[model samples]
Target: MQVELNSIWQLKDLDGLNDGLYRVLQLYPQDQIVIVFPLVDSKTLQRPIKVGFEQLNEALRVGKAHLSSYELPYYQLQSEANISASHLAKRNEKYSLIADLISSPRFLLDLVEQPRIKLVSLHAKKHNTYVQNLYRVLNLYWKYGQEKNALLPSYKNSGGRGKSRVAGTKKRGSPVQLSCPSFQAPEGVNTTESDKVLFIRAMKQFGLKGEKVRYSRVYDKMLKEYYSDELIAAEAESRNALIPSYRAFIYWIKKLFPAEKLIRKQTNQGDFDRNKRGLRGAATDHTEVPGSCFELDATVLDVHIVSEFQRNHVLGRPTVYCVVDKESRMIVGLHVSMEYASWRAGRQALINSFTSKKEYCAEFGIEIEEDDWPCNHIPQRLLCDRGEFICKDAEDLAVPLIGHLSIAPPYRAELKGIVEHRFNILNEKLVHELLGTTKGRSYIRSDKDPRLDATFTLREITKLLIDEVLEHNSSIFKDLAKQSALIIESNLPPTPLNYWKVHVEAQRHALSRVDEAHARSRLLPISKVTMTSKGIRLNDQMYYDSSHSDFNDWKVIARNNGSWPLEALIDHDNSSFIYVRLEKESGFTRCNLMRESVNFSHRHQADILFFEDWIKLEKSKAKPTAKSIERYQRRNQVIKSAKEELAQAPSLDSKSERTNGMKARRREAILAQRLGEEKPELKQENSFSEFDVYKEHSDHKKQKVVSMLKRKQVERDEN
Candidate 1:
């Protein structure tokens, strides 16, 4: 009896294929019939049928069948009279089981050969747990069987046994050595736990002795227990390596290849160079505004804050701020202070520059007629970038305070070349040279030992910066500033500064801090107080009271409210209130005298001016009334009870000669402080005759200068 299959029925044995085909063919009409199939590899289709490896066999093409389980090379069917595909497929084509291939039992019986009375034998394939190895099972009960699983046979002594080197019954505490076995490694072998267990079971099913796997049994145990999914997945992918779909490819790749290899495949060139150029371009343009540009940066100077002059006690590296002028190339107002670089520091820098500029103008024989910003008359401008210290809150405080200032675009540093160029020079000549050639990043550390100060002191550095700026402004140092200004004045049609003037005049009034609004606010009160760091309002205009710590940025606290007798309210935080300075020198003097008066007997009972005056007045007065004496006694009792004061007063005249020197020194110090005159350094030696110069001078030059100084006669005798 014979049955028919299509041109592409690939199989490993005829046991199932022959019976199925013979049964199906007998159900077809008595004549030969045909079926079509696609070309494919049979091994690939061993399980659920590999679509990519299908094939059309010529045996099936000839209305016959072959049970060879492999693929054939061909495409498209040749002759197909009885072969009809699934109703939806193309005519005369392919391996769609369009019709029933497996016949019924009755139909298959009718085609059987009568003489031999043959019945078909079927080998059914099913998925089940493969239990081949039985040694592992036997080891569970037999200790000798378990011991037999070792790589090296265990040695048994009279009393005890030593563990084997390769085939230990127990696991090692340290890392197990890894090695390949003597046997050939399995193809598509999963070097994982589950696969190892399966391999052991398979060997047991055959009743084999300990069969050495290609990899270590220790690793196999680890893989079986800990890496089942990975092992299964790896085995599946190895078995399905020929699949065409992306899912199949990825599954295999994930198992066989490292993750980094996939990443490398995804990335490309050309993207790297583009990013590098963008970063470099960003660092060059450091600022934002034009001539209205100033770089206000803070750093700690190379000095400790514990010095006698700086005991006010600020924290960390005491900060120093600088507002650099673009055009003048000058550090206008620099604060070597503890405070942050804020709007206040910015104002200080601007005010400092203008104050110095005023001096400059005065030197040039141009007395300022109007105390205006000189926006037009002086042709001055403020230039800087957008920063908290320079233009905080978007210049909410800066623009109005710095009159006639123009702001540049953010990050457009080339527009403010004056400052940038000056900073470049500073970096090359000052900061770099100071910090050290190796200090690539520009930073100033306030350490006791700063490398920059080896040749330059703090005072010297400040002087050098100032002198450099002055030299820049002068007809010296190559005259870049003068040349640039001249070139702008001569060419470029009109520079930004010159052209900006037209726009500035329109905005100039708005830039002033002192105006109608300020006047109504009572910003103006008095003007005669020497202009200083604390700017006071007077006549709707702010004036610098020079008496208030000239070069320092003072946080001037005002007292009570804005009123008469304006003074520095030094101990308050409210800046809006008017400052009222008490007569410090006089109060100080009185306090000192009172302290002396308490110890009058210490001076040999002789009294000083204030104390003597008090005593004389007391002695000359009439005797106190009963009520007055009682009140005085009560006050004395209270004073004595409150403090553990001395019992007796001092004698004042005991140190008369010593007192004269102190008095003279005090008087001189007071005079010098008030007059703002500097004194010369006093030499330790008193060898010089002060009157010798007077004696040498002509009558016209001398003429009893200073009542013919006391040293005159002494000098004459010595000569």
Candidate 2:
């Protein structure tokens, strides 16, 4: 009565399965012919298989069509019956005899007239339970008098119905649906929501990593389109809920957006933190070869270098970016620049890393040999943090310069832990002991702490930093396991001078010009031609006679940046955007969409701005009255910062600082930042040293801006 099905190929052993069948004179002389097979495999029982009986009989072979993976096989039709090979194999001899007897056509025809045959029982997980349940519910709803689309069966509202059984709605007549977070990210969790982890995961699933940059704009497009759609269950972003302290918000925003910046954090907990002390954790090293990867990041000067440039823009404190071969921990490029950190600075880091050039050759009083590093096989990967200088726009300066560029995962500073940990050690052993009686400058104030001043300044600090780096490479880290201060063979395997020696002659020729340009070129100054509403013009001279043909119906704007390698801009006649002509590319590239949604946003902004500007104009036009608009200016800057942070997902353990400038392959990151540094601007200005002084006096600037804004608010309130 019961049998199991197994591999169909076993049927080849039976004469009943032969393609050219012979009518043998049987002793039973039965009319029906039956072929029985037993299930001997789990796969056969789990799924169904259907093979054309005629084809199997004709082929007489165990091939693809005659044998399918799905094994649950049985057929019975007028005077004929068949069972799977698995079933036949599993059946008892008595059942085998019955199968032989049923092989007669007469018996098969008679067996087909029988009312029914039964299956013994179904096994667990063999059933599609959810689909079955769904079908059952649908059948019952249709068969019974259950009202269509109603949450409850045969229930009525407003008449004589029992109280409803669900949250938010009675279960009687109304259809009920519940809204919840897509996943279980907390209601106020800003990190998960804004970081687009789910979206990014989907991208990874679909192999859309590189495509995300372009597709992300599509998402922005969608968000704008659905701006008015009801999105409930969202927390009302507030200053109080998020803005823990001014410091926290500043920290949060600093890590958002073009979220790469030279990071400087000190972790003295060394090899004792829960992380380092934990078990043999996931051993993560993407390097396939010893020197395949070279990671570089900059830390604040544990010690500074004195300014040596003619203009002598005293760096005050010098910083250096060191490239370390992950496997050997060799110093590839060791560059110590003054106060300026530019996109060019990042290129210098990369170039110096590979080529190992030195600006301080005279100071060292030695001509270091070139490294002659392999040119054909560039480092497989460049590892960097999100820093303005490194990951400047779409081109991602570091990535294109090498084969692959991998960002240190957000907050998982451990991925680049070597660099980070080394910096930490530098801070502890070198920077800490070297402060001496000298004082480091207070970032928050212009004045130095008397303790700090007698201790350290620009010259001494820079010198100390240089010495620390040299000492760190020349000594420490060779034996971290060693406790005592002892001489060790820690060394820069390939010095800056030696790096260039290994580079191939062809590579030398190819990158020689470009590399030199990268080093010394005025990156931010380049030539460009533009047209006003009138026509195509370069430096006010018309290049094209009139805006016609290619120039016809195109408007242009002067894009200012690099003063050489001329570029131009053109307006599109039909599209909702403009285009740019670059130094290399033949076609004009398009820009961000300022379309219907953007127009709508602008209009909405205009309404609010109109109200604001109106209020300002009205304040100038007329004096205050009892019902006058109260100027609550500068009331909640701290709160605004909190809101922005709260708009972010919850903090991961670490963060970075970066700026959004043009996503160009080559840019002067020094000047390539949004004019508004996403910070509340103050009246403080210094034309040449504006950015420099602001950075130097950041804390003082912060305090002054906060105070000045409050004062301005009070003055407005008084009027």
Candidate 3:
């Protein structure tokens, strides 16, 4: 007899029990009530039975359990109040009989075995025992339980009964209606077309920007202006349906218009545009293979990062540029710097995308495998917006290296949504949780200054970005629809790494290592400069290799046209070195600035700017002076004397020193050798020929140095 919700339960045999199946609808523990419906016929069900769980348990213990089961019929829900009110208002005779049958459940149960049930009505002259009336009462009980409203007749009077009752016509009760009313409208004046127009005008006024009038205020205004005291009285006297109840008017307003559409119409263009696409409608399925479409975009990072070199120097917000593969929704590459979104930043981000991230991770002390971030290949198509993306620098580099570069229309951010979404994911995973983060809109932002709360340096934030990117790529997304049989069969989880491996790996087109190096070389800015006797002149600085090889090797070419304009690749970040390739060389050679000691060596663009400012300040303070040659010579002599003294003096530790006894013996041996050994060696074993020495020094005699002609003549003579 115990049952679970929405489960099929069979009643045990009892003396008064009917043979049927019961479905548990709802259960109340404290009341021990188990409401169920009995399926008397195959399709239709009897009244929903309200039996106590304890009583059912007792019956089940004493009687045998039935095994047959049945499916519960679908019951549509509808309010019975209107029908019941109408029936009571009409003083219908059938309403009393139906109410009595529904109220007396035991009587209804007794009549279940009876062929017909007697209906006693005050309007009826004799007792009516029609099976149809009994069936109607039983059907109401089954559908709507024992509620008094269930006995009320339907509102629709559809029977074709003539209005004039003839004398010969059989006496009958009023026809019962089963159809629901078309409009269960409130008791109020109906609104007219003119009123709707007025309401629209009111809505427009209320929805104005910065005004944002409340609905209650708008309603009051409508009452004061459109439905004035004079109009209300006139409409009431004429029984005109002009003014509507507040509730009904509000309902009509909601039914006629949607909130989102209204907001879009009244809001600013920026917010309106976003509302037009919204969150749901903007998504586009990426079925293309990875590397075919890549989105490139940049955003200012929300978190504040300080300079690693200077702690107090808060670097402000750094711009982060990312390239996202559309197919896998993976962040292929990212660049974070204090620099804004410029072509230089975009170029660096592109290079990162085409290079393995393992080395990059190692730089940040994050141990990651090459496979963990497999997005190193150049994309077939690069998608970007119309910022630095269309600049000359990007065009020059991408045209030769990448397969294609595409520029999206202005204000169409959805075109590069993958990278935009990647930026959001990065913010959520790393930036928002960090200290000194402006997490939301400017108006809603906290009063506390994020710069003051900043804890991590630029390098530390870079590490955090790397970790977040790794997790984003490898973590299971679970966003793919599970209904696809192909996905289920593949057994691959919805992760960027998995998607890349499953779909993009098989037909992946990648650049070779040599090609990658060539691409990198071509991507850098190229400048044509002349090679002089000193070296390649770049601006005010002279650049050359250590052996002055560039001057020697390219000097002949410069001599051909008096000046050689060779192509030099320059990185603005580092000023000390520039790359130059000779006519015969396959790759460029790095040339360093000649006077590095005077210029403070290689410097980045920022350092160079600072250096230029220092030079300006120095020039402003410095004054020209005249000096005597004698004084200059005297100063040079003092420097020369200092250098000579340093060279002649023995160092602190001398290899010539020995112990006192060893030194004495060494001195005695040296003295003995100086006295006798020199005399024994007086007879020279051999001596250089005086004639040959005199010939080498003689003015008349000459000797030819070794030459190719001389070597050829000597070879012929020997043969």
Candidate 4:
């Protein structure tokens, strides 16, 4: 019988229970109960009991107890009774009902006055029983004052050691315990110990390593080779026997060669080396301080998104590049796009780590304060894997701007565990809960297709990511800070924002005004361009500004050559301008595209890619529409107009090529001119062209004719 814990039982149901009111603490093969008496200490009732009968009867009459109800409980006891001290105590006569009933005043008085009141079994009317004689033994219990002496029968050898047994009666002895058996070697048929050794060795050689042999084939071959002297049985009872069973042979093979050892023997050295390295401590100690170290990595976001420009078109997964500060375990920067992890995406993520994110978040439609993500400082060192950071382009772009750049060994991700763990944290807490999420692996995902369920566009996902990152930064790091000594040193609340505030002042790589400009320019994607009078060319467009100091510096470096190749850096997020470095100077000059309002209207990289792809798709058709051609023609017209304006303007001579005497004369004339006086406007026709030498034909045509004559003269001279 079983009773539930903390439940009220009826008085009639208390017949089989112990004589006390009990609170059910646990239930299993037997009930675990505690007495609920108001006068006694609850600590004294800490010991569990099998039953409490009188306590239950009193509780049913009172209706309720002072103790609170147990809401949830678990009961786990042994399924089978084993010989323990508690079980032996329950069988003692002191707590037994027979002793209680016999010791009652009415039963004792009746038994003492009438010696003829015979003991008989209640269930069987004709037979006397141990229960009926309990009354007669109660008198001896008062004299002995001990349960053992009172319960023992008067007859010797109580367990029937020398008692006579009936002819049909069955005998029983003390029970023996059962347990699992030990392993034993299986003997081969018709083989001695030496032959068995040879057989086992042959089995291992044929099937264990190198080239594997089918166990069925080994069994068949063994049967054919049996009865030979080298493979003969030695036992007398079964001297000549058949081959052992296939199952038994396979079992022995498994016992001799374990799976783990076999895999280690067959696998390559690289796998073993990786496993050994993973067991050691981290190769880097980046938890010194916030902004002292950062890790850069990229992963495909779990949710599928569509192009913001095209609603029906399903863009696949977006690659999310993250830059994580090692000490605070906070994401310093993140960039999301359709491009895979490369130098382009890596540089963007790197720049974002050092730049204020307020405007970046605003561009994605999220309004966040700057202090919420106060991680806009240059880091002392950058850590990355052997992907983009190993490339020459990444090194050239990052090495000059940052202090130290280190790449972890191939196939070792634990070195950059900070960023990798943040990716996992984002996927679990944010991505998995959103719509169109793959929810990780196929076996783990539900039946719904992630691509079909996609509803958010790339723009929408960017906004969601901004909000998620902001929440992650501000949220309490209760578990992480409790374990990290560096985070606890901040002496503030355990959160990324709080930790950063306490430690940001200690950063050694704080950026100055000039250093900040240099860092931003270096992280932008670079392009080689020829410096023309109009400016540097990029993406089929010319970016120019005469007021730029770098333009004058570039002239000094390329005084002899009309045009020289120089690297121009571009901001992919803002196509409004570019930054170019002078060949002779260290500073960067921002150059705006010549006619942005007409042709390249300050569009982002995503829109540019869309336009290029759209043109390609239109051209792939058999015939393109007039509108498509007109759009292409309009773009070309704007570029052609900017060139015509630049060509018609007066060319300025290189100041570096001018003599010192000529510079002095020009400076005197500029000083003599009044500040407010207007200079005379020049007409389209030149006032001095009337006296020109080649006025009859245009100067260009005259130069062409002279070039023809000169070529003929050179040909005759060569002949």
Order the candidates by TM-score, highest first: 3, 4, 2, 1
Each prediction's RMSD over C-alphas, in Å, is 29.1, 35.8, 21.4, 22.8
Model 1: residues with Cα > 4 Å off, grouped in runs? 1-336, 358-396, 402-424, 435-459, 470-719
- Alpha-carbon TM-score of each model against the true structure: 0.27, 0.29, 0.50, 0.48
The 10 consecutive residues of candidate 4 with the worst lDDT sum are 70-79
- Candidate 3 runs further than 4 Å off: 1-190, 204-248, 258-264, 268-273, 276-284, 362-369, 390-401, 440-446, 455-457, 480-493, 508-514, 521-523, 527-566, 570-579, 582-719
lDDT of each: 0.35, 0.38, 0.64, 0.61
Q: Going through the candidates in order, what is the number of backbone clashes in each? A: 63, 80, 1, 13
Give the lowest summed-lDDT range of ten residues in model 3. 162-171
Local accuracy of candidate 2 as per-residue lDDT tens digits, 316-365: 44455666665434455555554244544455556544533333332333
User: What is the Cα-based lDDT of residue 179 in candidate 2?
Assistant: 77
Best by lDDT: 3
What RMSD value applies to candidate 4?
Answer: 22.8
TM-score of 3: 0.50
